[model samples]
Target: MGRRSVLPALCLLLLLAWGQPGAAQAAPADPPRAPSTVYAASPALAPGAITVHPYGQLQQSDSLDDYDTSPAASIADPLEPWNRFWFHFNDIFYLYVAKPAYNAWVFVTPHQLRSGLKNFFSNALFPMRFVNNILQFRFLEAGVEFGRFFINTTTTLGFADVAKGKKTIVPVDPTGEDFGQTLGRWGIGHGFYVVWPFIGPSSVRDSVGRVGDCFTDPFFYVYPWELATSSELALRFNALGDVLPLYEDLNSAAVDPYIAMREAYINFRNSQVKH
Candidate 1:
C-alpha cells in the first residue's frame, strides 16, 4: 500500500494498541549490564512491557554505545518535577504506542530496505552536520563531511555508505556536531534541564538549539505537511533501531530510567562540547 494509506492505518493501529492491555509473560532473567556504564530503567515500568530509548539526544542518531548513566557532570534541573512528569508521559507512549507501530512497519518492510532507509536518512542529513562543523570553525571536519557526502551521494545515491570498512578511504561520520554543540562551543552552558515528551532529554539551550537545527534540515521545508512530518519521523524511527535494545538492557537494570537517561545525556553532550 502507498505510504498515505499506510500512515493513517498506522496511527489507527497505534491508538488501538495503546487501548489494549499489555500481555503478561513470565518475567525473564535480569539482563547483564555493561562494565563501563549501568543503564537504568524506571521501576514503575515492567521489565518487558516495551523498550524505547527516545531522543533529541536519542533523536540525533549518533553513536549511543557509550552512554554512561553515572556521569561526572550534570545540568541544572530546576525543572525536575516537570521533567519527571514528561519522562513518564514519554515512557507510556513508548511502551504502548511506538514499539507496536514500529514493529508492524518492520514486518511489512524488508530488512535490506530498512537498512537502506537508515543509511539514506544519515546521508540526507549531511547539511546540518556540515554547517555546524563550519560554524564552529572546524573546517577540517567540515571538509571531511563534504568529502564523505560527495562520495556517498555519488556512489550510492545516499542509499548506502561506501566510505569505509574493508576497502576503506574516508573515515566514519564525525557525528555529534549540531546547533546545540555549536552553542555549547560558543560558551553556552547547559541552561537547566528539560525533558520533552517524544523528544526525551534536552535543556533550555539544547531545546532552542533544536529549533536552530531544524532550519539546517531540508525536510522541514518539504511541502504538504504529512510527507514532511512522516519523512522526519521515519528518520528518527529508522535511526532508533540500533539503540532500542541498548535501552532495553539499560532500562531493565535502572532504578529510575529518567535519571539514568538525564545523567547520561549531560555527560554525553558535555563530551561532545569539548570535541
Candidate 2:
C-alpha cells in the first residue's frame, strides 16, 4: 500500500481504540506526514477563533465523497519517544488480550444481544453527553438528549434504541458530542498528540476530557472498584466487536505503524474538534 491508504486504516483503528469515553473519531484520509507538523487543532483561523475543521474537512460536502487529504495542522510533539513506547505497548495489548476476548465475546453472543448491550451502554452514558452538550451551550441538544434518554429508558429499558426512529418528534441521535468536543468548542488547543497506553491515541485536551467524562459515566455510580472496572472493561469488550475490521485493516496496511497511526490519529482528532 502507498502511504495514503495506510494512515486512513490506522486512523480509524486509533479512533476506536480502548473504547474510552470521549475518544476521538475520524472519517478517513489524511495529509502527508511531516515531522514538524503531523498533529493538531490549528492556531485558529484568527486569534481565539477556529473555522470548521481548519486543518481539513473530515469528509467532503457531497457526503458521498470521502476524505480530503489536505495538509494537516501542526502541534509540537515534545514526547514522541515516550508516546511511541506506549504505542507499541498498546499494539501488543491489542494483539494478545483484546483480540482474543473479542473473539470469545463474538463466538458466544448473538449479534442482536451484542447490539443490545451496545445500545444499553450508550443509553447508560446519556449523562455524559447531556452534560457536555450543556457545557457547550448546546441546550437544544441537551434537551434532545434528555428526551431520547427518557423515551429509550421507558420503552426499551435502555436495551434497544427505540427512540431512534422517532425523528419526526425526536431528533436523530448525535455522536461525538462530549467533554473533549466541548473543550475544543470553548477554544482549548489540542496541545499535542500522545499515545496513552491502552487508551491509544489522544491529546492533552482530550485526555482531560476523558477524566471529566468518567464523572458522568454510569460506571461511576456502581460500587466497588472491581465492579466498576469490570463493567467498564466489558463495555470496551463489547465495543471491540465493531472495530475489529478496522484494527485488521490498520495492521495489514501500516508500513511504519507507529508514525502512520500517530499521524492518522492527529488528523482524525483534528477533524473531529470542529463539530
Candidate 3:
C-alpha cells in the first residue's frame, strides 16, 4: 500500500479494535525515593553527598555506587528565563490542547489499538534505528534491526509485531537510535537543555539530532512533504493517546512539575547516552 493509504487503514483497524472490553489502565504512581544509581563523573563524592556513578561502574568504590535517588545532578541551563517561558507555554499547550485531543481519542479507542499503533510506529521507524546502530558501530544490533524489519514487514504488514511475538525467532530491541545518540556515543556534550514550543523537552544535541533523524524517516522520501508531515503528526497524536491518563496523576504528585520533568528528562537522556 502507498503511504497515504496505509495510515487510514491503520486507523480503521484501530477503530475496529476499540470496542473490545477490559481496557488496561495506567498504573498508579509509586512513592518517590532517592535514586539507586546516580550518573556523575565524580568518583569520590563527599560522604552523604548524592552517590554518583557513570554508565560503567569502573569507579571500584562501594561508597559511590550507593544508589540515592536525589534529584539528578543539575545541568547548566543558560537560557533559563526563556526556557521557563516556553516550558510553561508547552505545559499549557499540553494541558489544554494535546491532552484534550488525547483524551477524546482515548475515550473512544481501546488500549489494544493504542498499543498496536505504538508498535506500528516503532516498527515503521526502522530506517532511523538501522542507520544509527550502524553509526554506533554496533553491527550486531544493526543486523538484529534488519532482521526484525524484514520479518515483520514481510509477514505482518509492518503493523503486527511478529519479531516481538512469543513464537518469533527474531530478537527485537525496540529502543530507538538516532543521530543525537550517535553523537552521544561519539563523546559530544549535551550542550544545554531547552524547552521548545510544541516539542516539549529536548537538548541542543538532541534537537539537532531530531533534524537529522527526520531525513532518515522513510516517509520523508516516499511521500510528499505535506503528507509526510501530517502522517508523522497523526502518528505522534495517536501515540500520545495512550499516555494521556497519567498526566494528571503526574502533575498532582510532582512538587514542581516543571522541575520534575526537566530533571527527569535530563537524567533519562544522560543514562541513554551513557549506555
Candidate 4:
C-alpha cells in the first residue's frame, strides 16, 4: 500500500502512545511541566509591551517558511550532535547568505521590485491552484490565496503543484490554511517546538503541515533535471528576497532569540489551528 494510506495509522499510533497506560504513568500527574520562566531574565517590560512583543514575535516567526526546531527545543532540552550540526549550518546560512542578501535588498529599497516579481510568479501559477481549489472546494485555498495577496505573495508560488498535474496526482496545497487548522480542529495539540535544519521554528502540528506542504508544492512536480538546473535556483532567489523582512523582524524582536522564536511559533501554530 502507499505511504499515504499508512499515515492515518501512524497518527493514530501517536495518539494512542500519548494515552497509553505506561506512557500516562510515565507522564507527570499534575500536567506537563511548563518550561521554566528563567529564560525571561531579560529586563521586565510593561504588560502592553510583553503582549505586543509576543504578538509581533509570533507574526515574525510565522513568516519564516523554513524549519529551525533545534535551537528552540534546545533551550528546554539538551541538544543532540545532529541537532547542533543543523543549528550551526542554519546559523551559517543566516549569517552569510540570508542576512547579507536581506540587507542588500532592503537597503536597495527593492521591496516593490521583489513584490512584483513574486506576484508575476504567483499569477503564472494561479490557474493551477484555481482549478485545484474549485475541484476540491477547499476553502483553505482561498485563505492561502488571501494570505498570498496580503501577507506575502511568495506563499502562492509555494502552493503550486505543477508536478502533481504532470503525474496526474491530485495534490493538495500543504501550506493551505486547511491543513494546519484541520489538525487543530481534530484535537491534535501543538507539541513542543523544534528547529528543523533548513526550515525554521515549528511545532509538531506545523511540522506535519510542512511535510504535507512539500508533497503538494509545485517544485516536487517538476522532474529532477528541470528542478536542479534552473527552476530551483529561481524559486530560491525569489523566496529569499521575499522573506527578508520576516527574518529581520524575528532577529530584531526575539528576547531569548530562539526561545522567543519557539514560543511565537507555537503560538502561531495554535492560532492557525484555532482558525
> lDDT: which candidate is best?
2
Model 3 over residues 159-210: C-alpha lDDT tens digits? 7778774433333336656677677677676777777777766778777777
By descending lDDT, how would the candidates be arranged? 2, 1, 3, 4
TM-score of each: 0.70, 0.72, 0.69, 0.52
Candidates in descending TM-score order: 2, 1, 3, 4
Cα displacement (angstroms), candidate 2, residue 203, comes to 0.8
lDDT of each: 0.58, 0.59, 0.57, 0.41
Q: Quick one: best TM-score, which candidate?
A: 2
Local error of candidate 4 at residue 98 (angstroms): 1.5
The C-alpha stretches of model 4 lying farther than 4 A from their native spots are 1-33, 36-89, 102-113, 123-178, 225-233
Name the lDDT of candidate 3. Answer: 0.57
Better of 1 and 2 by lDDT: 2
How much is the lDDT of residue 124 in candidate 4? 42
Candidate 1: worst-modelled 10 consecutive residues by lDDT: 14-23
Q: Candidate 4 lDDT, tens digit per residue, 190-214? A: 5544566656555566567444433
Selected candidate, larger TM-score, 1 vs 3: 1
lDDT tens string, model 2, 73-97?
4355678778878878888888888
